[model samples]
Target: MIEIVEKGVTNLELSKHLIKRLNYTQWKRINRFEFAQIF
Candidate 1:
């Protein structure tokens, strides 16, 4: 039972890390798009 709980915690942390990475990439893309429009 303890192992199951630990596995769940690990999965949660992994997903959170992935989400942060995805957000950073998306923000960079948006900045590039806006910069292009300005010129």
Candidate 2:
């Protein structure tokens, strides 16, 4: 999804912003999921 967004986004600034936001969101979500399973 992030890769698709990056490719589809024409504006450089918007692409950069989305990339950072999506990456961080995915990271946080994955961490939370893993932490939950650890219990």
Candidate 3:
């Protein structure tokens, strides 16, 4: 059905956003840890 397809698309977009956010957070943590070690 058309509604199901739309829901799937919405879910995919949401998942992508969540993944990007998580990746950004992880990268930030790694950078902070490295900086702390250097200092």
Candidate 4:
């Protein structure tokens, strides 16, 4: 119960870290394109 919740939180943090590390460039590009489309 508590342990499961802790594990889930840990996994979420890990995945967030990984996405930031792996997709930072791609994310920036997408944001730029999105901003360009809007403006």
Q: How many residue pairs collide in each prediction?
A: 0, 0, 0, 0
Error of 2 at 29 (Å): 17
TM-scores, all candidates, are 0.34, 0.30, 0.33, 0.34
Residue 15 in candidate 1 has what lDDT?
43
| Whole-model lDDT values for every prediction | 0.54, 0.54, 0.53, 0.53
lDDT of 1 by residue, 1-39 (tens): 356446665644544554576776764565545544543
Best by lDDT: 2
**Alpha-carbon deviation at 25 in model 1, angstroms:** 10
> For candidate 3, what is the total of clashing residue pairs?
0
| Local lDDT at 31 for model 4 | 53
Give lDDT: candidate 1, residue 14: 48
Candidate 1 lDDT = 0.54
lDDT tens readout by residue for model 3, 1-39: 355446665644544554576777664665545544542
**Which whole-number lDDT from 0 to 100 does residue 24 have in model 2?**
71
